[model samples]
Target chain A: MSLLTVGSVAFDALETPFGKTDKIIGGAATYITLSASYFTKENNLVAVVGDDFPQSMIDDLNQHGVNTEGLEVRVGGKTFFWSGKYHNDMNSRDTVEVQLNVMENFDPIIPESYQDCQYLMLGNTAPSIQQMVIERLGKRPKLIVLDTMNLWIEIANPDLMSLLKLVDVLVVNDEEARQLTHEYSLVKAAAKIHTLGPKTVIIKKGEHGALLFKEDRIFFAPALPLEEVFDPTGAGDTFAGGFIGYLAKTDDISFDNMKRAIIYGSAMASFCVEKFGAERIMNLTQSEIQERVSEFVKLSAFGLA
Target chain B: MSLLTVGSVAFDALETPFGKTDKIIGGAATYITLSASYFTKENNLVAVVGDDFPQSMIDDLNQHGVNTEGLEVRVGGKTFFWSGKYHNDMNSRDTVEVQLNVMENFDPIIPESYQDCQYLMLGNTAPSIQQMVIERLGKRPKLIVLDTMNLWIEIANPDLMSLLKLVDVLVVNDEEARQLTHEYSLVKAAAKIHTLGPKTVIIKKGEHGALLFKEDRIFFAPALPLEEVFDPTGAGDTFAGGFIGYLAKTDDISFDNMKRAIIYGSAMASFCVEKFGAERIMNLTQSEIQERVSEFVKLSAFGLA
Candidate 1:
């Protein structure tokens, strides 16, 4: 099974309590591809960048078996750039700048070879674009996971809702889940959001962990408790990559498999926060990933009387 | 194996996002006794109340097999009364009023009949008061569990540290743990806190769940996802009751037994928040608890691929 992800591929300047970083290779697609690369080699990338985007970054993804044939580059424009400073808690942040130079008119054009991808990840973006990608697919993928934020729910709720109906899973933070449902309790929020369309709803709580709700069943996978959270820039997108990547590798959508996927995703996310702007996750090895997953197992697994 | 608990038995007026409650029978000892009562009938309660405290509440505890012989009644004095209003998110609250009338001068006198108790729970209170109770015990219990909050740590840091040195286990919320150790990450906080005397530290995250840390080993137990959280008051004490109650019933303090205790505590707490005050947990049956435990089992139990 091949995994295809579409979202921002740009530059980011991050300032965290621990330290700050200048413009580095960062974006939803960048994080996703790196995390997913750990699970499988059959990965396809789709996004619009600009001439300012570094060639070395592209080479990094290509070397990881991520096909960039669908990556569109506009010669005269600048790549999307985001600059943010994280608070002491690392969970909250202040956006210093957002330059959507090339992404302003992003029109994802799916390549013919990418048509056979069995898994699709729609990173945080406009709902219309997500719908366009779904429509262009000749046949529905085995699983379509959609990731969105409070911005889309506030500006394009109707369109987002329509797009939600076409996806298999929806991932949003706890606050966004509540905002989308007007419910404070995550359990209530999941109930209402599941009724909105998707069969499964994942409410991410950052350091607290993530909750997976499907019908009458719920599974919780805790984020590995760390000594410090250096940066939380692309933790969510990295989580999505590991989740979909694991699913593609296993080719199983069962809840049991999804539970492991959540753990794997959580492990990937734990590494993402240990460095400034996705640096730690980029160098994660298979053994390190397994060690983190085992840590999660130890953290959450307990024998009951 | 008899369980002995020393804390306040008073009334609370709580205003939450869901609704408001009149003076409800509350207090650390009250919630602990009720939660522990579910596991065993050998519970000895020691606390101070006043004439204003109703006999009906005593009768309620007596009905649950909680011995009230050690409960001291101060005639013509007011009971400890606390009034708090929860924020819109329900994760935080503001203390509107705190009248430590009877509790101000509480000096717990352990009854001769309770002297044989083997398990002890020192609920959140003034550090001096908690230490006094521990000193009054004729013999050191098999396990001594202490609960404290930021208030005590801020006002009585030296005394609190002394008391921590005497206890086998420490229970605190995430924020309190952070405050006590001046560590931001909970994992780091637990590591720092564990070096301060207690062999085990349980960090409660309220709706998120709880983490039990012993040396290098850690276990995470998730709070049962509920559709509504009517009131969160006393949920932590309730959890402590369930936890210590299970340990007393089984008379084991091994790491495996501690894991089971945390799960039982998590299950009881899940019921505690389903209704206003302790209304939902007050009449929970064995079957109801079993069902909730099964739900918790499903929520956290998953096979790894």
Candidate 2:
């Protein structure tokens, strides 16, 4: 099965309580492709970069069987750049800079090869761009998962809602879920969101864990407890990558299958936070992924007396 | 096995987005006793009330096999009265009024009949009071679980830390865990707290669920997804009750056993929020609890491909 991901391929400067990093290979698509690459050999990536973007990063994705044919690289423009400093909690962060470089006019064109992909992952991006990707696909993929933030909910709510109707699953953090549904209880929020469109909703709670809600069924996937969380930059995207990658590999959208997917996603995200940006996940191997998943199973599985 | 719980037994007036209730039977002991009562018939409750406290509420405990012989009813004093208003989120609340009538001079005396209890639960109360309960227990129980709030952490850090030295497990919410350990990550917080004395730490995250950390093993239990949360007043106490209650019945503190205990605690807490204060959990039956446990199994269990 093939997985298609659409998002930004850009640069980031991240500052966490543990340390700081200079320009690193970051962005939704970069993290997603790297995390999912461990589970599957075929990754169709649709993103926009610029002349300043390093060829080494693209080559790394290419080496991992990521099809960058759909990626648009502008000759004159600079790559999208973001800088953020995480607070002591590491759950909240302050955006110091958001330089929309080549991303300003990002018009993703899904190639024919990518169109045949069975799975679709829309990483955190503008609602219009995500909708355009869906529109460009000739046939609806078996599963479409969307990752969005509060900014889009505030600015492009209508457009986001329209896109939500087309997706099978919605992945968002707890706060974003609350903001979108205007409900404080995540269970209620997931219920209300299901009415909006998607049949499944995964609410990611950073270091705490992630929840998978489908119809009346729900599953909780705990993030592997780590003594030190150096950086949380790509944790969310990495989680999405692991989630969709597992689902695509299995080709199952049932609630039970999605539950396992959430655990796989959480396992990948736990590794993502071990290093700054996408460094840890980029070097992650299938054996490491399997080991983490086993740890998750131990963390959650217990026989009742 | 017998379970001993020490905390306040008072009257509460609460207002939430769902509705409001006036002068309901509340307090840590009330909720804890009721929740624990589900697991076993023997519960020794130690708390202070006053002449103004209603007999019907006391009778309610009697119905659940709660031995209130250790309860101190001040002849001339008034019952502890508390009133709080919950925010729309239900996770946070503001105390509008607090009248600590008879509780001001509460000197818990473990009755002779309750002294042989094998399990003890110290619900959220003054740090010194918690220590007093520990001192009053003639023989060390198989396990002792203590719950406290951020208030004690701020005003009685030294006392609280001293009290921690005697308990088997410490239960606190996520914020209190951070405040006590000075660690932003829950994983790090649990590690630091384990060194303080308690062999285990359970960090409660309200609707988000709870985490259990013991030695190097960590377990996550998700709260039941509810359609509505009428009140969250006694949810934590109820969780503590369920946890210790299960432990008392099993008489095992192994990491594996504690994981199941956490799940039972979570299941009881889910019922706690379905009605105002402790009403829902108070009237729950054995079959009802078993059914909820079955639901939890369904909610969290998934087969990996």
Candidate 3:
């Protein structure tokens, strides 16, 4: 099974209560492809960076078995750069700077080899751009999961709505869900979302957990309670990666399989927060993932007698 | 096994986005005893209310198999009264008024029958009064679960700390847990509270869910997602009631059993918010309870395969 991830692959500077990072490897596609690589060897990335991006990072993706032929490098432009500072709570952050040098007016060029990917992940980007990628695809993927943020929901809602109709699943945070639907109750918000587009919706609550809603069924998975969250950067993207990656590996999109996928996504996200900017996610062992999944099982498992 | 519940039995007027309620039969013990009655028949209630409190409510308690011999009715006094307005979100509320009439000098009188109780629930109240009830008991119960609000943590610091040492479990909402421990992360907050006294800590996150931490084990149970939360008053007390009630009925206290108890508590609390103060909790069938518990199981239950 093959998984295609489309988003930015760029640099990020972050400052958290624990410490600060210089420019580190980041971006939705970076986290998504890296996380999905663990579960699916045929992980393909379609993102745009600039010549300023490091070659070693691309080599690292190659070693992880992520196909980078679709990753475009602008001749003289700087890589997309974002800098943010996390508050003491670590749940919210303020973006200090963003320079979409290569991403501005970017065109997604999917390689011929990536046309066969069965699972598609449209990471957080302009809704119009996300739609463009889907339209340019040779054929619709078996499952399409789209991720979007509040900014787009505010300014590009019509486009986002149009994109929603084309995707199978929509992932957004709690606030975004409420803002989009004008509904305070998430159950109602999810129900409204099903009418707008995707049959499946995932509302992510950082540190609390994630809820999966489809038709009349619902599933909840709690985030691992860590002593400290070093950096929350890319945790969501990593979650999306682990989720679709697991689905791709299993090649099953049933509701039961999605439940297991949510757990795997949460476990990967638990690791992402342990250190700054996907550092922990880059070097996880299969045993660590298994143990973390087992922890999730123990954390929520109970039987009636 | 018998369970003893001690807390305020008074009146509350609430205004929410959904609607408003007049001075209703609302109190910690009222909700606690009512919820626990569904699980344990040997339920004992100890508290003071004014003669103004309806005699029919007492009869209602008796109908639910809750022993009210320990409830005192002062002929000249008025019942304790509280008023609050829930914000549109329903997660936060503003206390508009408080008239601690009978509760101003509530002295919990342990009855001969209650003295034989094996389980004790000290619902949210002044920490000093909770301590007095424990001291007056002829013998320690098999398990003691204490619930306290942020007010006690703010004003009765020493009394609350001393009471914490004697209880087997301490249950508090997320904000109170953070305030009590001065730690933002709940895992760290629970660990800090563990050092304070109680071996077990349950941090309730209203609609988000509840977490149980005992020894080195941690379990999570999610609050069932609802279309609307009619009223959130006394939800915590209802949860406490269901928790200890199930434990008393089963007479088991292992971590595994506690997990099931938490689900039961959450299920009962789910019912509490469906209508204004104790309205929906008053008449629930065992089948409905079992059905709600099954919803919880289906909500969080997942397998790797």
Point to the candidate with the largest lDDT.
Answer: 3
In order, the Cα lDDT scores of the candidates are 0.91, 0.89, 0.94
Q: Number of the top candidate by DockQ? A: 3
**Each model's backbone clash number:** 0, 0, 0
lDDT of 3 at B87: 93
Q: Compared with the true structure, what per-residue lDDT tens digits does model 2 show for residues B30-143?
A: 999998888877899999999888888889899988998988888999989999999986778999999998888889999999989999999889999999988988899888
What would the per-residue lDDT of candidate 3 be over residues B126-191, giving only the tens digit for each residue?
999999999999899999999999999999999999999999999999999999999999999999
TM-score evaluated only on chain B, model 3: 0.99
Off by over 4 Å in 1: none
Give one digit per residue, the lDDT tens place, for model 1 in B1-305: 89999998989999998889899998999999999999988999999999998898899899999999999999998999999999987788999999999898998999999998899999888989999988988899999999998889899999999998999999999999999999988889988888898989999998889989999998888988888777889899999999999999999999989998999999998888878777876898999988888888889987786
What local lDDT does model 3 show for residue A55? 94
Going through the candidates in order, state the TM-score of chain A alone for each one: 0.98, 0.98, 0.99
Worst 10 residues of 1 chain A by lDDT: A296-305
Off by over 4 Å in 3: none
Question: What fraction of native interface contacts does model 1 preserve?
Answer: 0.95
- Where does model 3 sit among the CAPRI classes? high
Per-residue lDDT tens digits for candidate 3, residues A1-305, read 99999999989999999989999999999999999988999899999989988899999889889999999988898899999999999878899999989898779999999998899999999999999999988998999999999999999989998999999999999999999999989999999999998999999998889999999999999988888888999999999999999999999999999999999999999999999997898899999999999999999999998
lDDT of 3 at A74: 83
Q: Candidate 2: RMSD over Cα atoms?
A: 1.7
DockQ of 2: 0.65
> Which sequence of candidate numbers ranks them by TM-score, best first?
3, 1, 2
